[model samples]
Target: MMRLELNLLIEGLHDFEKAKRLGSLSNEYCRESATIYLSQEDSSILGVSDGDIVEVSSKHGSVKVRARVRSDVRRGLAFMPPSPYSMALLGLDEHPSIIKVTVSKSSGEPTSLTTLFTS
Candidate 1:
C-alpha cells in the first residue's frame, strides 16, 4: 500500500477556542451511534474480537485503532470509539451539521496492543 499523509488547515484556532469557551463546542465529546460494515453482506463475518488492533484507512489517510465487535452479530459490521484518533480522518466541511468519513481496512500495517493513552 502507498503511504499517504493529510494536511488540514484549520482556520482561526483562537476563534474556535473562544467559541468553545462560550459553550459553542461544549458537546464536542458527545458520543453518537456509529456503524461499520466490512462489506455489503448480511450473514456477518467472524474470527475478530473486541480490543483487537485493526487498521482503518481511506484514500485520504489511514490509522491503527482498536476494534469493538458488537454482540448482535451484524455480519460485516464493527464499532469503534469516537475520539480524535478516529475523527482525524473525517472531513469537517459541514461543521456542526455533517461529518463525512471514508474508511477501509489498513491491511499490511503493523498492529500493537498499546493504547493511545498509555505513557
Candidate 2:
C-alpha cells in the first residue's frame, strides 16, 4: 500500500464546528471531526476517494478517518478540524496545530471518540 507522510494542520474552530460545539455528542460534529481533508492529487496517489476510510498515523499513534478530497488543500499537506481526534494524533506536541503524519487508504471504520483517548 502507498503511504504518504505530510503535515497535518489542525484548523481552528470552523463555523459548523462552533455551531455544533454545544452538542458535542451530535453525530454531525463527530462526522466533521472525524474527517481529514486531503489534496485531490494526494487522494489519487493513495487510491482513495472522498469519504473513503484512511489511516493517519503520527509518532504518537494512528487514527482512521474519512478522507475529504479537496482541491484547496496542498499536495503535501492535510487539514483536520481541532477535535479530540486531532488531539490524539498530536500527542503532546508544542505546536499542536501542525504535525507530521502518514496517510494511507484503509478499509477500517473511522475511530470513535470514546476509543480515541483510551487508545
Candidate 3:
C-alpha cells in the first residue's frame, strides 16, 4: 500500500515537464549536485557538524544524508542538496510539500548509501 502511494506521488511530480526541465541532469535523467542551506537554530538543535550524518524523515518516508553545517542561523530550518535521493523523500512540489526532515545525532547504517543511488 505504501509503495503504491509513493508511485502515484512520483507519477504526479513527473507530470510537470517544466519543473523537470529546470532540474539539472548529469546522466540525462539524474541530478548530480545541488546547494543546500541550513538555519542556525536548527543546526544547534540537531548538533549537526560538518560531515555529520542527518536522518530526515516525514509522514511519508525518511532519508539519511551527509550534512554540511553552515554559519548562518535561523531557528527550525534546514536544507538538503537537491538530488533524486532528496527528491524521493521530499517529493517534487515546492508548495504543499510532502516531507519534513529532521537532523539527528545517530549515525545511520552504512548500507543506506545504496538507497540514495537507487532512487
Candidate 4:
C-alpha cells in the first residue's frame, strides 16, 4: 500500500447523540469519536476506503482510527473528532489543534482507546 503522510487538522467536532446514546464508556462510541476524515484525493493515495481502520502516527504518539474518505477535507490533511485517540496525537505536537501523521491501513481492529497508553 502506498501509505500517505498526512497532517491531521482537528476541528473540535462534537456529536451529542454519540455521547447521549452510547455515552463515553462504549468502545463503539470511542471508535466513532476517533474516526478520521481524509480527502478522497488523499485516501486514494493511501489506497484506503471508508470505514477501513488506519494507524495515524506522529512524532509524539499514534492512534488507530477508521478512515472516512471524503472530498470535504483538504488534500494533504485530515480531520478527527476530539477524543482520547486524537488527543494522544496532539500531545506530541506544539500545536494543540493539528499534528503531522502518517496514514496506513491497519491489519485488524484498531487498538483500544483505554489501553492505548498502557498496553
lDDT of each prediction vs. the true structure? 0.35, 0.87, 0.45, 0.78
Score residue 35 of candidate 2 by CA lDDT.
Answer: 87
- Who is ahead in lDDT, 3 or 4? 4
Better of 2 and 3 by lDDT: 2
Off by over 4 Å in 1: 1-46, 72-78, 94-119
Q: Looking at model 4, how many pairs of residues clash? A: 0
Which parts of model 3 have CA positions greater than 4 angstroms off? 1-36, 91-99, 108-113, 117-119
Extract clashing residue pairs from model 3. Answer: 40-73, 40-74
TM agreement with the true structure for every prediction: 0.37, 0.91, 0.53, 0.84
lDDT of 3 by residue, 32-68 (tens): 1222244555555666666655555555456655555
Tens digits of per-residue lDDT for model 2, 25-118: 8888888888899999999999999999999999988889999999888999999888887888876645978999999999878998889867
> On residues 1-119, what C-alpha lDDT tens digit does candidate 4 reach at each position?
66788788876555524562777767567767768899999888778889898999987787787888877788998988767778778664268777778988886777686676574
Better candidate number, 2 or 4, judged by lDDT: 2
Best by lDDT: 2
Segments in model 2 whose C-alpha atoms lie over 4 Å from true places: 13-19
Ranking by lDDT: 2, 4, 3, 1
Compare candidates 1 and 3 on TM-score and give the better one.
Answer: 3
**On TM-score, who's better, 3 or 4?**
4
Candidate 4 residue pairs in backbone clash: none
As a whole number from 0 to 100, the lDDT of residue 11 in candidate 3 is 27
Global Cα lDDT for candidate 1: 0.35
